[model samples]
Target: MEDWKKLYENPPETGVLFYNETVMDHFRRPRNVGEIPDADGVALVGDPRCGDHIKLYIKVKDDRITELRYKVFGCAAAIATTSILSELAIGRRIEEALEITDDEVIKAAGGIPSGKAHCSLLGVVGLHYAISDYLRKKGEATSGDKR
Candidate 1:
């Protein structure tokens, strides 16, 4: 845990990531923070270096992502990113959902620290993994790969 006071103290040298209200709110009360019962697809990803883990679940209908849910075990950045990723992906075509970018998520979250920017990949990669799982189960090809 970071020292709250140290975080607030204006560091004349090194910069700090003062989490915006939006990020804090999302982290505190993340959206779609659970599993989908009988999920059509699921993925679990972890950044071994950061010890951050995310488990993503989804339900697809007619080639669209009708539902998305997730559980994150990591920093506030991880939680916030995944929370907003769910909002961005739900009700979109699987292809479109996979297109959700780190920039878009960061914008939706009102910007995260540049240092933690990589955390955004967790959500995007999670979606990719879960969607790929769905495609494989459906006996479909993903990214032009025959399987």
Candidate 2:
């Protein structure tokens, strides 16, 4: 296992493992960290297993996401992941945005800790939910929706 993982598994009683500079940058100055009042679609997703939740909002124009925003209530990883998701989704076509994966988000964020990888998955899931909501509102087929 990685040293960070070992440290996390057997944490010292008096210290905390700080997130890397990239993660800290995102967490401290998260982009698109709000709601879009005139959003074309909005989705709220939660990980019952981890008790983390995210609300994603999107504005679509000509089948492209013109704007993206998110509100996250979770750990630094969750917040950073969602922030990165918004950056990745904005200006992309709905299908293209849907193609975004957890791995991409993790890579864009300079890699999240293995134990917190689920947070990146949640970010992608949140974006998918938002796109699904947009399709549903437009009366389009949502058969491609993956959860």
Model 2 misplaced stretches (Cα beyond 4 Å): 1-18, 140-147
Worst 10 residues of 2 by lDDT: 11-20
TM-score of 2: 0.82
Candidate 1 structure, TM-score to reference: 0.84
lDDT of each: 0.89, 0.87
* Candidate 1 per-residue lDDT over residues 96-130, each given as its tens digit: 99789988999999888888888888999999999
Task: Candidate 2: give the clashing pairs.
Answer: none
The segments of candidate 1 whose C-alpha lies over 4 angstroms from its true place after superposition are 1-16, 140-147
